[model samples]
Target: MAFSETVKHEIMVKSARHCCVCHRSKGLNIEVHHITPKGQGGDDSADNAIALCFDHHADAGHYFAGHPKGSKLSPAELKKHKESWFSLVSQHKIENPKIASVEISIMNKDYPGFFSPVFIRETTIYTDRNSMRKMFEFMGKNPDSYVEEFKARFPQNDIYGKHKMSKIKTYDDLMEYFNGDMEKEDREKPNTDPQPHKFELSPFMREYKVINKSNCVLYLKLTNGDKDVLEDYKLYLNFENVIEADSVTKRSKFFDDYKYSYNVFFPENNRGEFIPARPVLVQNDSVTLDAICFRPDPKAKFVNLNWELFARGVFGSGTIRINIKSSFEQHIRERHVEPSEIKPKFIRILPKWNFE
Candidate 1:
């Protein structure tokens, strides 16, 4: 009999969506296998199921035929592997529940007497098991091929910097190289120029409004007002008291006490991708943006929070400071209160033409 949904979910969760035998993530392909053949009286229980990647599942002396009988993995052997994998996954999740994502913003830094527009492509990488496994497999198989693919995706230019191809032999080497690059970038200074070109808020930006605010939820709308095309515009929020929580803070003292986490949603078009703490591309004239502050302290009656918004794009960059006073009591009392629309009190825009 086929495995039930509950059994499948249990197996996947326990194994952390990875192959039990090889400990490989489920990026390439993962399959659920029966420890004991149903014909031998095995029921569809999670204990009887094991996860395996395509490579290990079909390998000789494992699950398929054409291997010596003694070399084949028995049901007991599969169970042992599954138990070990589950234990490791449980420990990992306890130590690190969520992975932090990285984003490198690509922008043109304006330098005096230089009219050339520098092409900057910021790459974001998530260091999850699946992502790590994919990088390991690809780089280990052929580092040159991986480098070529990256170059194709983000073409290097003379204004920014050259793309140095990495020569990595093992998974450890690849990870070391990646971490080194991230450290170097972190040490570098901010991309924005010291003397930014200033401009008044465009018509679209002037018309922007705050639709509503509830218990930790803020809704917004943005419309493109410039005639020139705007690509890869981002909304950056820097919170005052609530530091953006991440897995790195799992051991920190403030991890539990931190009352809020930030996330964005594009309600107008579901197709748009929302990268945490990164900009979402807006192509249309208008789009609805939702900022969700989750995991509020239930005991607290009111939460006073402050954040700043930094908007960046090819056209220019701008910054705005905002303060919000939210009360759970008020929200509870007036659940159906109309949205409180507000304008951009003040906006400072740095245009691209000034640099040229």
Candidate 2:
């Protein structure tokens, strides 16, 4: 959680692996040193970073207050060196083709957190009179802690099925009917409301909440190479080799629900509006799309997200390969990540009519 991958990439490209202090190319033997120590309240930001060679880093990092041998590099001095080198690189003192080559990379490891979707399920029960009465009476008394144990297994919220909203009350309603001639008039059974003679029914409702899961959340990085500014760009994407079992990332109803040919989402979205990750870009600017959580489908063995970006006078396209297994591994901390196999808890019953 130090300087973001985007910030580090930008600083590295700006410095070209050269030590800002000694001005020597260290190749990969360079480090982005913090101008202000973190414990001293330094923030993980580009302006607070300065690239340095190993030797200079050690020199700048080592200093004993009581046994001071020589003056260490000052924060102001580091900032000046970094600014001078960055300006020189950008102003053509040493040309870097990377400056003009747009690049995109998925920094999954760089991101520390992941997004998770939720599940909502509801089931209805049906049966004949005597069976239903027994069931309700059982429900009213909750023998053997069946209801509590059942909920403990599935872990869910409920509706009127187990509360005051129910049409039948085990004693007040059912026994009251039993005290009347209604049973004799009907005869077949007592408490005959929607006869619970059978103890089975059909599935009623189930839902998955995945809209936010399709957001662009991660240390996903994109850099603009051209010196000209990029403006008013919309990103278009499509998934391939997907199945119904896959997570909503692939099954996105975006095309059908929103009339977009490809899956489209606003960058850095907040209630469908843009934040920092705007639809605009400037020269040598690297953007970390961290505002939302747009990820690969969780059940597909392998998937591809083909993307196309278009601006007023610019167009770019590429494909992002998704490894389903790796996707779940990446979010091992999630409570209910796909494909969830918590041995789902449930009580089965068959119904006659469909529930809406």
Candidate 3:
């Protein structure tokens, strides 16, 4: 076998190793991958390869298709992936092979300078999971103003689900305990356990409307005792709608799971002007849209649309809309309505511009 001596050595080592993602034992059928696609200026050197179990290899291929952090694959990890690939090929007893024929497929095309590496400047926060839970339990019951103060003091630390802490019974209840001066010798400091909260509830209610022939709108309203306040809110329209089967994209594409509402719009589109789209929460009430508008494509017959939700904590609900109209129809009837129960995150009533 006339394999590159360097490649041969790498294969020998990784074939005896374990899979990276799952850390499971690497049995046969493992595959190799180039973390950065060769088509996107990646060299075919061992520094860019990685050995993955068959499933991980497929996942790596999919992630590499448009992976933003293409240049950051570590040399060691790359070597492992390469070794796995070579080991498989060698086991098949394939004779000496030509390298140039290896037309590595490259997906995800972005223009030059479109994406750069992500620089994660690290700071000391709640590295301990126990402390993280205590922090969220502390944040849950505190007033919004107090939470903001805590955030400013500990900007790097998250006090909520971002840290995976769900044991907190109440943000205020936690705050009461934390603020109480129990001496270091006090027996009732706080319970440091990972037991998840039995019934985790979000104080905020994200509301939205899904019109049959119109786009959806979102409302993020926070409940504080008897008063309702709107926190800093914005609407986000995802390429993949996670709400219903009618979505153009699949659920796996959606990154957020706990999200309630998908998109939120306000003031209706009939006015023919761009509303700022941000809504102010009315005290003691949930943010609701007055009306929703649709952009009718004059040349199209119909339009399909769906929504996703984004929130600080839990999301609301989502929905889809199919607007049908004829080209000859002018001044189409206004359509779109709010969804029930599920409050989505970012909500927007999209415009199709024309009917098919």
Candidate 4:
């Protein structure tokens, strides 16, 4: 009788919520069952009671394997059961709503880049469509700010994998799936070839060469193959706003290979393998749980070329390589690249191990 109005409303909401186990709406027919019997010491509070259908309430006492027939539970047992029911309801509600997460990575050569993966823990309440629209509109005003806000809210390990998302097997498939939800005007534009993701080194190709006149800096050059998909090689560099840079004239003759890739010549650390197409065991021991990885050699070359230019353009300056290799052909050559026009695969880039 001393319960506050807010507490009473919350208890009403709990009753109105669908039943935790049977998926049936509580509505007006739900009965508040005292988890702990009055004869027992169970408190007359919302936590000690749960809304359940008549049939479910009866079945609960008999369904479990260890539950006794006609064996009534004590007040303490009922209270414990009610608490368990609340936890179940919370988990179900959280997973059924929209959720978002963020991932961050460091740009690397052999790998796509070093990034941290973050997940969303619970469902965010938007109250109404207007509230959601306002947030989306706010996000549209400044993408960078929106991205920052997103990263901040969904910080590293902020959420855990409580539910699974629809997995995207390939990039193209993922885009086409999203295209279904776009406006008519947005979809009308000719779908240009896949563009390098903003974080990729397509636009800002890192070039590496020994400058004799003033040997100061070092970098590597990235090239596109002679293929339709190669046209999508234009990428955004993660280095931020780099207004301009200098190019090194010196060239090496070691780049004569059938294929070309963005290689991180000196990968400081292994942030795991990039786009590994299933790990082939190089070595296995029955006694020990350690093994070596033998990933696909997709970067293996078929033809050799002059080493003057890695693929095209001068070193140091940003450049896009265009070798024009058909995506289909690339797929036939290797299944690893089959799923997508641009399969993010890993490569070994040690200065000493020249592809030539």
Q: By lDDT, who's the top model here?
A: 2
Which has the better lDDT: candidate 2, or candidate 3? 2
lDDT over C-alpha atoms for residue 57 of model 4: 68
Clash number by candidate, in order: 2, 22, 59, 24
Question: How many clashing residue pairs, candidate 4?
Answer: 24
Error of 3 at 146 (Å): 87
Best by TM-score: 2
- Relative to the true structure, how large is the alpha-carbon lDDT of every model? 0.42, 0.49, 0.34, 0.30
List residue ranges in candidate 1 displaced over 4 A: 60-69, 93-356
Q: What is the lDDT of residue 241 in candidate 1?
A: 28
Per-residue CA lDDT of model 4 for 123-229, tens digit only, reads 22212223333565676753334434444464542232212112223333223223332133333342111111112222457533321110112232223222211
Over 4 Å off in model 2, which ranges?
63-67, 97-356
How would you encode candidate 1's per-residue C-alpha lDDT over 162-189 as one tens digit per residue? 4333344444443444545423553545
The sequence of per-residue lDDT tens digits that candidate 3 reaches over residues 235-299 is 33322221211111111122345232323322222211111245444344433322222333333
Query: How are the candidates ranked when ordered by TM-score, highest leading?
Result: 2, 1, 3, 4
The better candidate by lDDT, 2 or 4, is 2
Off by over 4 Å in 4: 1-8, 20-23, 58-81, 91-356
Residues forming the 10-long window of minimal summed lDDT in candidate 3: 97-106
